[model samples]
Target: MISEATQAVITHYERRHEFRGDVFGAQPYANYGYWARPDLTLEQASEALTDLVAASAGLGQGDKVLDVGCGYGAGAVKFVKRYDVDAVTGIDVTPVRIASGQDYIAEHSVADRITLQEGDATAMSFGDESFHKVVSVECAFHFDTREAFLKEAARVLVPGGTLALTDIIPRRGVDPSAYLTGETTNQSQVCLDMPANAYDADVYADLLRSTGFEAVRIESLLEWTRIPFADALARVAAASEGERAEQISRMATRIRQLIELGEDYVLVTARRS
Candidate 1:
């Protein structure tokens, strides 16, 4: 369990938003689109999904997908509908997120294809080798330990299964404690009261390998950051009004602030051995 203090901060933060994961849950683009549009163009949505699907190439018609820290269940629902994958199970420790995702699945009639549960990453509630693909989109940051999260991920993933994730990775070689403190010590814009151990690309790769995952690949999200900071800022400022507007503006400001403090966006892919 996360520290009670941490959990309280997380609960407060998530309860404020309709979605669970911070803005840019998976793709900075659609993430940016909350303020940009209600009906994002298919083109916009597909680009974000390109990286998402490419990471899980082996998933087939009947394969199951496990999404840890599933956020609002966008990737989960996408996989079921687009690939006709047999099932998508999304789990989050945040109760509100599970509830919101449940409502989304029910409202969209994707209930047959998607499952959302209140679960933990450090101690997953699933059978060994239960899923063909495992994904945690920008949510693993909440995990208190690297080994715990990787162990649970590897335990539940089938041999030769794939794991894909896009989250804030520390810029290579930087000490996280330097910039992480105070408000950051609680719930910084980048992560929620989370001191990241797998932020470094090499460190993340090493952890995956140790957990029996092979061929791990970690890439810094340099290209994505260039356009998003400005776009996100502009969109939030333009779309927000009254209390909601003020909240979004503050959140957007914090995201950019964290990005500036550390070049911390990373995309990782690995296979369960």
Candidate 2:
């Protein structure tokens, strides 16, 4: 059963789905694109972020992968095509995204290699050791409790299987609750639903270790992710008009607020021990 918090998150995304294609480009990615270079378009940068996560997970040929919180199965399809992964099973709680992902999978002609289903990440249905790699991109913070999802990821992966993800973590000396309860714009308010246990880099690494993962590595990707994305959003807002422009402007503001709040955009990798 979906918790109230998870349902709220789903509702937020449901609303987002209406205009995500207009704002996030034609593809189905709902992530902060990794701006490897200044001139890359949003679609290219978004694909780059997915590639970064796949590389971090050490995805290999014939690997069976599980993507938790896979938004519209874009990353999963990318994994199968770009990384030569044998297959990818993507699970998400949002129904509309899953429906869209199914269409995306069919359109990409990878329906045989990818599966997108609506399901909870914190409690998965996969058997133990069912996958070789587990990945989540920018969606862990909304998982009700990221720690619980980590444990579940560990449970489903084969021994020594890798888990890689990008997440937002509060910087040292920052109080998450302050941001949660403070005044927020519409775009910012949607993200304030982050769980209490979402901790700093140090605590995050320790949490991974305690959750049956080892060789934990956490690297800040703020410069490549949120910073560039925010700049791009501002440009979009400036070039556009009407409600769409206002929405993009608010999103840019929210991204800036996160940066000012000392929130670190990080890429984390670990292996099941």
Candidate 3:
């Protein structure tokens, strides 16, 4: 039972998936990846970000993991192969992403270890205490109300299980409420869709605690993720031509604007209490 807001997000992704694929490549990741090194390629940086999130979640062999907003199942497949996780269940609202993820899983020969389904994150169907850990990479901000997804994560995670994700939040002194009222300028549609209450890290931590999580840790990855990603986009825009290049240039400009506006890209981790 996807809510209308969630459906709108699905539609947004479906419409932009092709353009995103062109920009991010065929590797099945849609994220502002952690650029660990200045020379890393986009795919490499994306994998690095996935590894960072997995490490933050303390993934272990035989762990059952759930990936919310798992785009194209790349993170799920990586978790299985890299950490030897017993199984990974990935859920995303966009049907096209699920279909592509199925193909990716089949190609990787990990069909038994990874499952991708079209489902709403804020209202998942999994039973309580269903997973050992939950991880989302760079997509949680798109959840209708990130707090709702946090509650769902708490419900599905085993007691003491971990949750880790990367998200975008407004820095102190910025009013996320303005986003709700359409007062913010130059914001991408996706940013505009983020619930106002999710804009601040302190509020985010409080929401997590209230939703049954503890020991929350939020680290800004602005330098590693957003800055590098914008740099890469600028390089791409310069090297490429035509509409794709124009799109890349626009995205680069948007990222720069976000940076100036004090938008923070953060990695947050917590445990179900």
Best by TM-score: 2
Residues 1-273 of candidate 3: C-alpha lDDT, one tens digit per residue: 666666667777787776774667768888889998999888888989999999999998989999998888989999998899999999988899999999999999999999899888888899999999999988788787788889999999999999999998888778665444443223225424556345678888889999999999999999999999999989988998897788789879877876786688999999999
After superposing candidate 3 on the true structure, give the runs of residues whose Cα lies further than 4 Å from its correct spot: 177-192
Per-residue lDDT tens digits of candidate 1, residues 1-273? Answer: 566644754675465454323344343123322112334433353345444443445566888988877766666776776778899998877676677778777877899889999876788779998988887766566577656888998999889888887666668777676666646422334335556453678877888899989988887654454235445544755665576556656656666666666647666889899
TM per candidate comes to 0.81, 0.96, 0.93
Q: What C-alpha lDDT, on a 0 to 100 scale, does residue 258 get in candidate 3?
A: 64
User: Compared with the true structure, what per-residue lDDT tens digits does model 2 show for residues 1-273?
Assistant: 778778878888888787665667788888999999999888889999999999999998999999999989889989998888999999999899999999999999999999999889999999999999999998888887898899999999999999999998888788877566535347424543565655899999999999999999999999999999999989988999898899999888977987897788999999999
lDDT of each: 0.66, 0.88, 0.85
Highest-lDDT candidate: 2
Show the lowest summed lDDT stretch of 10 residues, model 2.
183-192
Candidate 1, clashing residue pairs? 170-199, 241-245
